[model samples]
Target: MRWLFPALALMVSTAAFAGADTLFVGGFQNAALARGGSNFLWYRVDRVPPDAADPVQSCIDARDPYGILANYHRAGVRNTVRTQLRAMRDAGQQRIATGIVHLRAPAGQSVDGRYGGTLIDSTGGTLHPRIRDNLVAFLRDVYRAGFSELLFRYFPQGDNTPVWWTTFDESLFQENWQLIRSIEPILQASGLSYRTDLGVEGMPRAWFVEALGQYYIDDNRPDNPAWSEYARRIWRNYVAEFDYRRSVGFSFVSDSDPVRTRARVRHLRYIYMLADGSVRYPPLFAIDIYGGGTTDERTIFERHHHAMADLGRNEPWIVAESYFNDAVAAAGLSSAMATTGRQVRYFLQWPLDRGIDDCGVNVAPPNAYEAWLRRGF
Candidate 1:
């Protein structure tokens, strides 16, 4: 009974029922606030060292001594996170969602492998013990921070080297599932509701079917032999596993490449409908509109929003990530917090006008903490 309603379901219901509501948005920084002209913020807890003549020393210096001490010493990072959560609560926001990357590196690790335990090892691999005790410590900190909702990024394909989709293997999938199970107790204890990002590439049918017992198919790829079988199994599994009243959903990533984008969109729509001809999942689609440095700002927003509206007619949609340097560079677009703010505002307003609800902002580092607070306010 306690697991009856996932946090995201509650959010969707609230948004759908509420009319003329202002979406409190936050992202990597004030961009969310600026673009949407809404009050919201998302904080980033991870530390990246500043640049210096000696990159290693600079990286070491960049580590937040207060954050580290707060985690390693004192009540630990969780306590420090609580302090930040309190700040947001004091600002009068009833709901707060925290974002944390589950990462691992040996003690005293630096970038460039000059020092051991860098983000990626010599073999161009992410740190092992990917989900470690420190992550538990961080989650405890998140709970202490007074957050009841969280957006967990299992593997951020964009920032991580080689990308998750490119290197995804059976071992990685198993590791991720193990981590999820291990943290379930903590999540339940903290009363935290979570949403995870499935990378844009969309997972293989076998991986999802084997891991979660359900696989999301890209509507764009309807003809793929794998999708038909996957769809069949999903229907059978859904009836056996989930309560119909509870909302089930998945995310989709749009690529800049026309061919890839079409394929993704087609596959996503196909999966949106179930064998019974009912909308099996909430239409909470996500697109990577960051442009990767090549898309025009207006064009990127317009195309992605229009695409989502076309596919997500009766359901809500969210941007999994936004305004990354690579996206901008790939699209040949130039944007700042102002541009980001405007786009978010447009997205929020569009849905409200159409009588639909629910949207989310992705928050990352540097000014993430500040952005988190701003959104709540």
Candidate 2:
């Protein structure tokens, strides 16, 4: 599924008042973060940057300045992203895309703690002071790095790939959600105590915990069905607790592979069901279009585009994470640039073509993207 945090419930409200069926306004809910309308940008720095300035900035500059993506695996990445964001602001880019990413415990590092004799984690050794400091420090970096939202996707892959979870079942699902809930209080308290505007909010996961819980039902385990159903019931409760407008959900085009497509389709259906039949209630959906992994780029793009024709049926959609893959390898740099331009056209046109409240597209390859932006594609 998709993932992070920039929103939570019982906090200040920023959602706009719109009709229930409509998903976007002028292609976005928040104009400031969306930059100049609904636009997408690159997600550079999969890991930590060696320095603050990105050497590839010249290559990846695009007009889609709504937001940038990041991960918290490496501590140095925060510095690099902050530097880039400030530079963008200095360059007169008023929108100043708020960098977004996740902050989770590293692999195999079981962090446990006790709250003044109240045990925090199953593991007994990790104390409250240690947990508070580490969690606070990591979250504080989110404010320093200029990230607008955070998604606590401890398990990165949407449909339960389970990097952090030792097992892929109900037990892990329960533990992870509990941990996320616990971390929220710490995040809030730390932000206040330190006097940092870390107003960091939560992002509804695309499918993370809920999906894994669903798997237990698929596995045909007795009693686990009730457990999984109960998980969904509770998730519905929590999502209701947190205002739905502040959350965003992730989606994608169905692949030619029937297996993945079936899984995604099922997940999509569940997301809708989770909304309790309210079109306006589910987290806003972002359509992911990373082209050409196992087939022609255009073919992939078209299928995804066509598949999502009814995506608007469930909820409003955005070209959440899209880019012309293999651009550098096809023809030459200029040809790739031209191809990128065409892809950009298709994404932008879809919203106009369908006449739905298309949220926006976030395309990458900043190296060639700036040129397309100049051409007004």
lDDT of 2: 0.31
TM-scores, all candidates, are 0.48, 0.44
Top model number, lDDT:
1
Estimate, for each residue in 321-362, the C-alpha lDDT of model 1 and write its tens digit: 333112222222223323433233111111011111111222
Model 2 residue 231 CA deviation (Å) reads 8.5
TM-score result, candidate 2: 0.44
Q: Write the per-residue lDDT of candidate 2 for residues 230-322, one digit (tens) a residue.
A: 334434644655544433433344244433433343444443346456433343444334333455434444443343343443344333333
The true-structure Cα RMSD of candidate 2 reads 13.2
Model 1, runs deviating above 4 Å = 1-76, 88-148, 156-171, 182-185, 198-259, 270-279, 288-298, 312-314, 323-377
Candidates in order have lDDT scores of 0.34, 0.31
Clashes of 1: 47
- Looking at model 1, residue 160 earns an lDDT score of 25
Instruction: Write down the RMSD of candidate 1 (Cα, Å).
Output: 12.8
Error of 1 at 126 (Å): 17
